[model samples]
Target: MMQRLRILTSHAAVNLMAAACFSALAALAVWGPGWVWAFVPLGVGAQMLNEYNLHRFVFHLLPPRAQWAFDLLYRAHYGHHDFPTNEKLFFVPVWVAVPMLLFNFGALWAILAALGVADAVWIAVAIVPVGGVLAFLGYEWFHMTSHLPVRKTRVERYVTTLHNQHHFRDFTKWFHVSPGGAVIDRAMGTAIDRETLKTRQRSEFIRTLGLRPDDPRLVSARRRFATRYGLTEGEIARAAAH
Candidate 1:
């Protein structure tokens, strides 16, 4: 397991290049002949929102009714949830990444071209890709770091805790892998904290029974424990409603 903690694998490097290059372009966009840094935030914000949308709509989305869609989405995300520690699973294979890279670049370029801003097309092109790839690289790095056995930085500890919260405490919340992506989650109203409920009393019961949250055997645990603790079904319903 300690050996698996290594970073800078070929897979990570390949996935990282898009962002590394775009970040340089972003710096140039800021300090270059055009001085179009304002668009950087637009790019960043767009990427942030895009990350949130992907997490919520795709990763967290229920596998569709259609078999093919279900298999596709399940392979994309559900397996990650089931096997969170598999470093081998973390890599986006070159085969998949190449097509996605082309599509993302072409799509953003086409979108910017359609907007028809006089001097802004090139700026938009640079900004858009920089924003997205930057966010993605940050996400992959953050996520991988969160799974690392040794966490050191203040930011790492914070984001890793949130990532743990997403995996174990509550899967539906903390969907964003980037720590500050919580801002987008909050703005969009999906930020939830079950920590209070999990830690204060209910979690005590869960611990006492030694039941994992995902344990099928614990299917009635929350309801029964809530009842014993005098919480009404309505309260649980309301909590879930959020």
Candidate 2:
């Protein structure tokens, strides 16, 4: 009922829509020959590099000092970190995904135009967007399974276990969502040690925004949303007391 509708409106749905649209565009990119498609994988390498940069540089720039930035992090991410088991927070919200797409695609357009490669830019605009869509779709699926309950094949089970270690064990380590995606972290020297993230603190601006992680309002909202889909959290942690 409402839950299904909610999922459709969620950010994961945006990824699905964007992927389908770009895939169709790539298929019908009549301006180029069949050979142009062969070179698209090269663009994927660039997209993967962008993904690594986003996770490392932008995402980790959390605990903001400004209210606007804090709210942005709240909607885009960080909320997921607070309640990893909540399916509602697992996907990218619409607010976050739209601007990110504009920036990535716009930057690509600008760079291509700057290089003075008119025909080449058109080809890139087509193929590169498709690659980015597919990559993000794969990542969204992987991230969802890591948080929400679903039967996993042996390989899925293995990789998701690796990813969940980031949530339950050490947030500082294992930023890569794809299986064996840690290669990027290793190469970039961002692979952190265990529990290193817990040593850090949230920004004061977060308190000012009054949208602190896992607040009752946030939790309750998620519960209502997940309950509609029969996707309530499977486990809860109890604080220790004397």
RMSD of each: 10.9, 6.5
lDDT of 1 by residue, 117-181 (tens): 55444565556556556666677677777877774579888888877766665566677877689
- How well does each candidate superpose onto the true structure, as a TM-score? 0.67, 0.69
**Highest TM-score, which number?**
2
All models: lDDT? 0.58, 0.57
Off by over 4 Å in 2: 1-20, 23-29, 192-242
Query: How many clashing pairs in candidate 1?
Result: 0
Instruction: State the displacement of the C-alpha of residue 92, model 1, in Å, after optimal TM-score superposition.
Output: 4.9
Candidate 2 — what's its lDDT? 0.57
